[model samples]
Target: MAVEEVFYKLYNNILIETNLQNTNYDAVVLIAYPEDLNVQLPRHIGSFLEKAAKVDKHITKAVTVWNCDYVSGGRLVISPTGKVTPYHDVSVVKQAAQKGVLRALEAGAKSPLVVVQSVVHFPDAQLVAVLGVLEALYTPLQMRERVAPKNFTKIGFHAEETLDEKFERIVRNAIALERARIITRDIGGSDPERMAPGKIVEYINNSFSGENNITVKVVDDENVIAEQYPLLAAVNRAATRVDRHKARVVEIEYKPSDLSRVIETLILVGKGVTYDTGGADIKIQGKMAGMARDKCGAAAVAGFLKACSILKPPHLKVIGVLCLCRNSVGSDSYVADELLVSSSGKTVRVTNTDAEGRLAMADALFKMSETAGKELNPHIYTIATLTGHARACYGNYVAAMDNHSARATNHSNKLQLSGSRVSEGVEVSVVRHEDLAINEGKCKGDDLVQYDTGAKARNHQLAAGFLIKVGGLEEKNLKYTHLDIAGAAGEAPSEPSAVPVLSLCHLHKVFM
Candidate 1:
């Protein structure tokens, strides 16, 4: 099952309400780290501790210390009386409470789901804190349950203090991230063979069935050859032989009601290869295990729309293009020496079929840039799980990025700062014209060529160069940034990282 299909069904109704009603709560979770154990609790909660100490002597004495360090995680206490949790770090106390509350309900609580959902109250120190807290609440319900009970759709923030706009913005972003996470999580767990090009389309279209202020358009496989989107079509040729799925270019446009002020459009392109079998140049057995998650870039965009369907920017329209295809093995697969035409009218000679992400992206980028060039001021950004070169260079903490557009150059610093603030890190690099020049030379007779299977580790830069050509960005002098999330695409092999979604959040704060 697609995580997007199940979890967000319930998550969509979640409300981030201020505690104006002052409803009496069944549980007021008081979470404290060991560091805060001896310190006096906040006055409001301290009142509960004093009363509890007189009634229950166990908490009155020193609480037992565990072996975990102060830098570790935190837990939730169900009682109004403050209690020591098993983990560390006071910041994560909010997360603890959400998780604890969900577990309690799953084990069969008698309270109506809505009452149980509304009654639990916790503290929110900042907006980013809401992200962690939502994780605790939303993730518990993401379990692949068949007949999960209907839950209370709203969450009441019962802080004694009121929240400002910044706090509310955080709450919105947290909600968005929760929506995006489900798609990636489900994709990470889905069988690679089943997540083919056709299946990817099914997942995407299903996730975005009916939404407001948005229109989803696609160039399906039926028109792949007719439209001259040859590169993307070639990538899915192998898969088409075995399945009905075809290479597709999905475009989602967000036009806010007040488009009177929108002059520039922000275009995001995501690489989607549901499963990378490497075609004729297949990967080794062990390396292909996590290959099913190749479509995560597309998942992020779908997730973003799921989260921000109603959050149309006042001054700008946002468009996302998902280059969806599955690089598989069959008689029809494009092999080395075959030349394919891109939507930009450029011909690409296949050198490595496994490097198919760029092929799918090239035509989609060309289509987006072409539209943006004529209609709106284009600010183009490409996000993909493209290369091992990036992962090898940056490890897993930061997603490696290449900025070529002048407008996007200014946001590089913001990307890193915001990444840290949101716990999604970034590392920016310079994709020089010279790098593009050299990679193009590999094309020889053709305009460009995918790198050979064992080619030197220039892939990080090389791949970006190829995408630039297909996008026709440099030709039009359009601004662009390429984010390669290969290294940090997932927490583990079977898990997907909500990587650049945080980067998008950072961008939303700035550009919107």
Candidate 2:
């Protein structure tokens, strides 16, 4: 598809309508608690709900459609968020908004006015609700090509109490986030062949062609990749022979216009395993069904860079690397028990070919670590759907493990808090001495082992340790965090969740 044709799909047709009585919209999607339906909602919506409550008892509890004349087309879609609790967070609001938008779409409403009744506990409820609505409205890349191109004509937002500037900021931030998420979802959720390494490079080149302050550099040559990123090249051994599925190193950078405004530098390396057949240690028993999503970590890196390109937040310089490769099973596939030298010069003994995501990213991460020392207050991150042990441990929540420097600064906890506010769950995992020890090579021939086949505990945490060791971050005094998104990258048969993009943006104050 042409760049212009696909560009519009990344953003929503967002419209902000402050006037509650505006009759231009086709439907009113109300998201609120049962008790606040009458109190917090507008007088017209509250009155309609009050009248409907007398006739229907389940009106306040379940998602329902009410016939009313106060709004446009006489269609009112009420999506109730269950009782808010101290334990509950903004995700409830996000989920309710998504459901409300789905219901509005089903009702044949091309334009819907969405309103959220904010809770005191969740300060970012309105923003979360808007994000959720965008999530529901997002059409997959393949669907946009073959089926419906867009979900709605326009999405309207109304806040009960807000100044014009604050409302505009909320809308702008949400749009930027959703736009970034669209890139992530497209690359993360597309079929393996559709989003092959070469195709991803093409899509990225088209997506960020003229975006200001953003630069993209791709390394596509096989010999150069083999020379510079041997570990990654090893994982790409079989696929390198095929032009379409060969490896790609996509480096994206965002720089502030005023160099004096920069206070810190952030480097992100993401594992873009377009398709993981587990190489020589091939996956069996239906385990390879959703392997296309293994690249979500890299997808998120691109999305985060997209957000940076849009917002152009000051005082920060961000660099993102998408370590793209395909771990294909063939005659030339890299097998286990092979010792390969990493970019950091550490010898890695391949213990399990299934553990390829780390190898795909290790060289880029090591290179980033080398550059982190010169940048201003730099922090490096390695994000990947690298382990099943993470899913076994956290179950659909991102697990963040910090190195010594990041742990000293309480980085993971900060991410956890920021993520919770934006409806993304982040769990903090500690990388201990044992975790590091698990990756220690069994024999004297290798410096580190690729996978800990013998030990059973902390496999996910150990993966982080392996990256730190192989990426040359160990004892480097550079702040680094490894995000294992195996469980949270997006469950099977669903669109990519674009995990941690909002969290990182929020933490860095990237939005305008």
Candidate 3:
């Protein structure tokens, strides 16, 4: 499918309403602070809430449905953002909006009007409120293609007391961000067979078929992968036995039309492990059930590139590399203690076969590191759901570790600032001398150890160090950030969270 048919046609169904007077909508989802419930609402709605609050003190704490005459279908959803404190952030607004939308869906309201009483403290409160609505409205790609195609007939957005020009701009920006997120959710949240390496190449090729300023290239030849990316090939050895599951390196590039406007370049490498069987050190105790989400890092890159294509921000060139592979177990599966030469010619000794995410993306990251010098002020990023340690360290927050060059400029802090603007939480972790030292090989034969077995602290940070060393980026003086989304990639039985996409987009000002 072409660009319009693939992304725009499927996702561009949000209707911008002029005001709350539109009676065509079946329900009105009001997301507001608990204290402002009786202030900014319609006269009848406000009167109803004023009376309801006296009888039911707990009405403001959770999602409540009231029968009112102010809107169509006489259904009103009062989803309140609980008491805001100094420690509270914008996520409370997003969560309330989502809960409000879910209540509307449950009430069979195909057309729900979402109204956000945005707080002054949170600058992106309105945009994030709308995103939460879209998150709840999203139907899985497989479900849309096979089961029910329509999640909602139309979603309506109403911003109180905002200018038409400014509201239009916000809606446009929200649409672009949600569209990009749909691509990530489609790839990251789909089943293993549906998003296998070969099929991922096909899906990406089809998505960007007729898009402007976007180019896609795939490297699928097994021999070529073995010759050029030996580290990646080692992980791909068993997957080659099955044609559909074979590895693929999908490179998507987006360069602004005016090269004169380009001031910097971003090289992103993603770990697209479609299904992580753990190779020889197989994940027992039923830990492998949800491994399909392991490719979220690659999925995030694809989604970030999608945002770039939509926003078309000037003064920046973006490159996304998806290292697609399945770490399956077979007779040929590379095991622990096996030595493999990385693309940068670093000999890496594998200490744990389950540590395949870094190996899968190391060669591609090295290749990008080799050419980063030619680009204007290039920054490289490796995004992956790499370690359980990250999840253990920070609950549902993406951990970011920066190389020395990135730390020199406080890149992680900049990212943290942007993440705070949006609702995505980013925790910064430092890659210390101890982290780098932990990855050194035991014997003198190898230049690096794939996984640290003796380390007790900073497992997630150490993983970043391994990637930096194996990619040969340490000596290049290039800025690199490793994002471990193991905690933020969404838990099982839920849609992928698509964390760093929104954060990265905001940091680069790609929000239309």
Which has the greatest lDDT? 2
Q: Each model's C-alpha lDDT?
A: 0.60, 0.88, 0.86
What order do candidates take by lDDT, descending?
A: 2, 3, 1
TM-score of each: 0.76, 0.96, 0.96
Please list the residue runs of candidate 2 whose C-alpha ends up more than 4 Å from where it truly belongs after superposition.
1-12, 34-39, 147-150, 161-163
lDDT for 74 (candidate 3) = 81
lDDT of 2 by residue, 1-512 (tens): 43323433322567777765577788988885756333367767777777888998787577898777887667889898877766877888898899988998898898888875555667788889888998888888887878755667887888864547676678778877888989999999999999999999999998898887999999999999999999999999999889999999999999989979899899999999999998899999999899999999999999999889888888899999999999998989999989999878899999999999999999999999988988999999988999999999999999999999999999999999999999999999999988887888899988899998887688999999999898888889999999999999997677899998999999988974
How high is the lDDT of residue 490 in model 2?
92
Residue pairs with backbone overlap in model 1? 198-245
After TM-score superposition, the amount by which residue 424's alpha carbon in candidate 3 deviates from its true location, in angstroms, is 0.6
Model 1 TM-score, all chains together: 0.76
lDDT winner between 1 and 2, please give it.
2
Q: Report the Cα RMSD per candidate.
A: 6.9, 2.0, 2.0
Clash pairs detected, candidate 2: none
Assess the local accuracy of residue 19 in candidate 2 as a C-alpha lDDT between 0 and 100.
63
Evaluated at residue 317, the lDDT of candidate 2 is: 97
Question: Can you give the lDDT of residue 251 in candidate 3?
Answer: 96
Candidate 3 on 153-232: residue-level lDDT in tens? 77888776444766677777877888889889889989999999988888898777777889999999999999888988
Over the stretch 1-512, how does candidate 1's per-residue lDDT look in tens digits?
43454443222444333342333222223333333435334344455445555766554332211111111111113322134454322224434444444543453322211111211122223343445445544442225445563553344443334445554454555555666666655544466545555666666666666766778887775565437567878888887656545677788877777878877677888888888888888889578777877887876776665545645556667888887778888887789889877777777788888888888787778877877776667677788888888888888655444445543556666676666555566786667775576557364568776654444656687678777766777666777778888887874433576677756755665223
Could you tell me the lDDT of residue 289 within candidate 2?
94
